[model samples]
Target: MQPIDKILRNYQSMIVSGAIILFCVIALIFAVIPSVQKIQEMFVQVSDIAAEAEGLQKKLNVLNALDEQTLRFQLASVLTAVPGDRSFPSLFETVEGVAARTGVVVQQMGLSGGTTLATPSAAKLSAADRKLGARTVPFSVTVNGSISAVQEFITLAPNVRRLLRIRTFAIAFPPDERPLTVSIEMDAFYEPLPTSLGTAKTILPELTAADNEIIERLGNMELITQSAEALPEPFIGQIKPNPFVP
Candidate 1:
């Protein structure tokens, strides 16, 4: 009903105010809201970083408190008791050592199960072995000795280092009071070392009293195999005043 010019003039202040408010709303939608979202994401990243740092600090503190020598000694004992791989040489040495100590003559030996030339991969393990997390190498050994010596051999075989379990055994009596022939079936246990470490946030496992007792018992076991030779010292190249100058 009114002229355009007149209506605009009458509502000029109100229109300017509305335009300012609309501009603010558009800015909030396009810029301010995005900025707020970015800030929130940054806060989340910082919190994650702080948590990771705290976890790493706790691990460092635990490492610092540990005695390296004692840990290494314990690890050596444990490895000797239950080697990380199927060490056939050490296993044979252990069996021979025990038989020697028990006054038994080893007549024959043969590997019963699995390939003796190479270690079996984890994929080749049976479901039960995978679940148990330990692989077994079955072998059989035949020995000739007096009844008392054979009994002692049987007793000592499982308790020696390079851990073994007697699965089955049979004895044959000779007619003329000769030494008895004993056939023993055994299984040696091995476990592979972990291929990867846990995440920084993962909690370190604490050794319980039972674990300590096991370690102590392993330490006391007779190590039949010879100790491994110490590693050679690392070579340090001659230092030059300027490494760039050949």
Candidate 2:
């Protein structure tokens, strides 16, 4: 038997309470849910940054183990053995030294077309070819020596100051008391060293067993001059006069 007006007022309050509850649910769906998703995304990004930082720290640690000066010297030796320049005179001197050591006499030498001089065509090469980062310069040389001497020269080619790969070999046995005439075709490779990679970052994954073996082989090479005092002039004198100099 409650008054009708009082019952109506009570119903109004209930409706207001329900409206408030509904508004709160809508806010959670529209606002709070999106905020939670954003927080999760930020957490993922932070995790990625942490992983990247850890990887960089590992790389820095690897670089810390190297002796910068010694690495530079070793790398310089390797690159010098296979120079980026068209240093024909240095190549010739290297060959002559090897022949002398083997008691052989170089009778004739001829360079291939692309190997002798750089032309306009060199600039027009495709991007892929240019990006290969290495080029082969080929040449042919004839020498006169005993078979044993020629064998010794072949054995020693890998240990020479300049990197030369024997591509073709032929021999003509002259009559008795005459030395054997040996013909050799070789490929000299050239690859530029990036300046960004100094002695510390020059090599990655550190030098492996095979890499150390190669370093050992190059280190054993009997260069023309070892002393710092004797290195400059002899090296300067040996390289070809710059063809581009007008």
Candidate 3:
């Protein structure tokens, strides 16, 4: 056997052996790594399920302890009470009735809201601007009638549909008015009925095409803001899309 030949043969054997060992190692790693990862994933999934099951069990135990009356009340609170359909028309008729019965001449039953203002004082002004609710549509009813009639209307105002707060009421008797008429500017508050109010949208405004678009935008914006507000502070950060990932 020659030295050079022996050296080359030894090197070839080393290469072959190394290749076989490398193949065996790669095969073993591929086989074991998946099972290990699968076991880990299974453990994670089981842990999450167990935690959820434990929480549900605790909740079930608490619910079992609640009395029937309490549960009913809770159910009632969770379930929105169905409102009557006669709410708007009934309100209008009631107001008209008060005017007629009290002998008050309703010069205008104006509503001002959403950047629109009318002579009947139908200014589509928000309650916040008019200082009613944080966000609400308010109307100012101007009436020309006897002082007695105005007083009667004011007195009967507390019974209006929905919770109406008389924000502003003033009586003015002009110097040259006939029949000793008094001009009454009274503020009547009403919620601009929402689509999904869990109650009902109270004020039904007849909007033009542009006005309708504005109103819808406002409603959508309000919904988004409300949904955003309901989330935790940490969720606020989640709103802006994560730039790092697709």
Candidate 4:
């Protein structure tokens, strides 16, 4: 053997140890480190999925506990009280019903602040009203009746199913013997329904005791107007061979 062979023989053990250490370092950089990072990423994904699943399970439990019929009734009562739109017809019906019940005649009626044909958009609402998530439609009614009848009308107007706020009123006493002419200015409230639903991870809101009490009160209130459209009749007969055929 030559001098180089002699040197290789002298440091063979040290060279082998260094080669092993270098191999381990390369593995750490190329494989083991990457594998550890991948494992961490998977753990994060699993955690997110678990949280989402828990949220979904909670939502499902709440939904399963709810009574559909009771919910529908409550919703109906609420919508009747504060309609999803202007509902001019229902408002008129409510006012007219109160007038008729109180032995009063509606001499004149006119809508103000918004068009009677279309629902007012949120952009048209004032900042305070928009913040409250409710819009008001102002209208004035002129009714002729006895003093007692007019007082009853005013008293019952706010308590009706269609919620109204009596902004102002004026009573006119004619020189001749005539019924009292009362001009009442009122505001009917409405809130538009949400156009979009929340994400799956969003939690459902729970109704509190106060909400239930309000719904109960609304349910007890008289509903003077009928639904604008009737519910579609349920299918009674057997299914046709071609189910797609109407």
Candidate 5:
């Protein structure tokens, strides 16, 4: 009876401690571990899915963009000409073609400082073969044509191999004897060589701009974005799931 009592008293604390530890372990495995493991697995799977989807989307975009650019591209071209070598004949010929086709009559053409100088002499020379003036000659072209024909001529002028600019256009609103005749005064600007893109970056003294706000904004870096078209998005999120549970 005495031995049994002594053993029970001394071992009582150990027995209680062991019971508490076992209960905690059971609770952790049943209640906490499953939830933690599920969260970790979900996170890993979601990350993998997101990565795959992103890669696929990028590939599709690249392929589609390539196809579009190759087949149907609409881009503006900056005219390049052999500056001083450009002659009035070629420029005049281009105007003549457009004007004649559009039913515009050229009454008088001359070479002058501004875009408008009526030059009848340019008709005799060839485009690549003629030189209107040394370096850049300011010439004027006067055409007796309708408003539509005049507009067509201006549009066609830039498409010519030799660069020409519409410095000023003066239309006969009240008009002379010919009511449909609108006089166009344009400058045929020719340089020695097509100015380099880098050199063109700088506005030269001879170069001129119009009061039109749109033209003033052309090639202005302050008004433009110079970064690459295609770029990557930055890191957005970082989520960590329980490691021990998995």
Candidate 6:
């Protein structure tokens, strides 16, 4: 009947529809947006977990390719050659065995200094150089035999239970009927113990082709597997007096 009342009646349905739309927009902003964000975060977490699982699978594949025996042997070689302890007596024992195998008499032996760090020369570096963060203990040894025996000893040096670097090597020939004398300045290197390395750690890498070659050579070398029964009795001998002492 009145103009204002007629307008209100005509627009009431439209106003109700607008109010419903507004409520839906508010719900989209507050509730729907947060639910969408949570879904996105869950997808991201699943992707990260998948990537980590893939990485672990790759590592397992690499490990699975190697047999238990070969792995054990490789580990043994690493431990025996690059032990964590000072193990000076073991070095002496090893050299003694080598000399005996080469048919050389140990004329003199000298031990000095604990392990010390040094930058390795590029020419002398090998595959293990990068893998092992080790230190060297310096020593010298003198033996006497024929030239052939000396050559054999040098050739077999790699088979020692500890890795050796020959710093100085010399030979002398006596005037009379006697064996040739050989002198070797050597260093025995050992890996630092884990407790002493502070934050550092060693992770043995997957063996490369070059590494496999070295391992094969080590396996073929007679001295690599030389039995203690084959070695001569431990010789009670003396080390040359330290020149620095006097």
Q: Of the candidates shown, which would achieve the greatest lDDT relative to the real structure?
A: 4
| TM-score attained by model 3 | 0.37
The candidate scoring highest on TM-score is 4
Q: 201-242, model 3: which lDDT tens digit per residue?
A: 223233378854643443332110011111112222245466
Q: Residues 142-228, candidate 2: write the lDDT tens digits.
A: 999998999998887656767788878999998798999999988665654332444432335668899988887877776642221
Query: Per-prediction TM-score, please?
Result: 0.79, 0.74, 0.37, 0.81, 0.34, 0.64
**Higher-lDDT candidate among 1 and 6?**
1
* Each model's total of backbone clashes: 0, 0, 14, 0, 23, 0
Q: How would you encode candidate 1's per-residue C-alpha lDDT over 1-246 as one tens digit per residue?
A: 468888889999999999999999999999999999999999999999999899889888997898978877787778777776777777888888888899999999889865445544443775545676778778999999999999999999999877899989999989988999999999888775554456757787777899999999988888776554332221233345664552
- 111: Cα error in model 1, Å: 1.3
Model 6, 1-246: lDDT tens per residue?
599889879998998899999999999999999999999999999999998777777767766786977676675555566555445666787788888888889999997544333423312433444444445667889999998999988877755656777778899999987999999988787654332222212233677899878766655554332332222211224343663441
Q: Return the TM-score for candidate 2, rounded to 2 decimals.
A: 0.74
Stretch of 10 with least lDDT, candidate 4: 228-237
lDDT of 4 by residue, 1-246 (tens): 699898889999999999999999999999999999999999999999998999999999999999978877677678888887787888998898889888999999989664445544444776645675668878999999999999999999999889998989999988887999999999888877664556867778899999888889988988766443332222324445775653
Model 2, position 130: C-alpha lDDT score: 62
lDDT of each: 0.81, 0.71, 0.49, 0.82, 0.51, 0.68
Error of 2 at 167 (Å): 1.2
> Where does candidate 4 clash, by residue pair?
none
Off by more than 4 A, model 6: 1-10, 58-66, 84-86, 116-133, 145-151, 159-162, 170-181, 192-205, 224-246
TM-score sort, best first = 4, 1, 2, 6, 3, 5
